[model samples]
Target: MKRHPRRSVPATLTALVLLAACALVAVVTIQMLLGETPWIRYDTVAAALHGTRWTDTVTAIVGAAAVLLGLILVLAAIIPGKPVVLPLRGDLDSGASRRSYRSTLRVAASAVDGVSDARVKLKPRTIAATVTTGRTTIDGLADAVRRSVEERLDQIDPAVRPTVRVKIRAVRKAS
Candidate 1:
């Protein structure tokens, strides 16, 4: 089971940059077609670049910036984002996503007596649960959550088993 995070952010950024460049080119071409003076003075710019030396500070800085931008874009495209699913141990190799696993752990934590709500954070090495309850005294609540979560983990048997850590919080109902 393999899963990767969405690349919307990088894709959107690249699209915006390309859109700006394409718009500039289109506007310049249209102005030239209409025989109007374009905002960009191509002759002056060409002459400036033609006279600029590779060792010149301005030319060197521009080159460095362009290379840096190109490198960043390349890396973003090539790098794989974090997986959406946590791989499991057993056979079948069906992609069991972390969301479903977290939800399962949440159900276990909430099943414990006195637990009003449960929030779970799952990492490769640790599974943390924050439990909210109406009971003023939270004695044994954390242990119960840990036991419940562990039981759920035993059932799921993920490839990387995370230790269960539970925190209990008390809340009073306001009328």
Candidate 2:
């Protein structure tokens, strides 16, 4: 089967990291099971495990289980990086998070009489609107965009104050 060349390095590193993590976990688990301090181990751990075959067997089984679990997790991440890597917008900490919100604002602003093109940016506390209105001075166009956005936002959250910036990129007569 054809494989993704880019997947190799990350997959190998993930496997290595998983192996090391499993080893560390096994060491810590064995230490804890033998009544040693979590961070610093006591000499009693070796003595107790050496004397008790049952404890030694349990430690071996648990260590193997942890190693197998870690390997499985590493393989899972390596096989499909999509689940491990979150989408860009998924990390957003904002109210207007949906892509449709920005696109809608742009389309809605451009639908106005003088607007030629528009871009909308939304953040947690503020919304910024930039419009290219077909006029020499964008003051009137900016006002229109602000009003439109404010009305829309008021329906959602009346308290939100938007900053609308209109730049007259180009002017053309209506056909």
Candidate 1: which pairs clash? none
Task: Tell me the spans in candidate 1 whose CA falls farther than 4 Å from its real position.
Answer: 26-39, 47-80, 171-175
Best by lDDT: 1
What would the per-residue lDDT of candidate 1 be over residues 11-114, giving only the tens digit for each residue? 89889999999999899889988999987878988998899998899988999999998898788878876669877887778657878988999999999999
Task: Give the 10-residue window scoring lowest on summed lDDT in candidate 2.
Answer: 81-90
| lDDT of every model, 2 decimals | 0.86, 0.62
**Residue pairs with clashing backbones, model 2:** none
Badly placed stretches (over 4 Å) of model 2 are 1-96, 158-175
lDDT (Cα, tens digit) per residue for candidate 2, span 41-146: 5466678667766547777898899899778867765664322211232234334434655676677677778787788876545567777755755557767777
Q: Which candidate is the best by TM-score?
A: 1
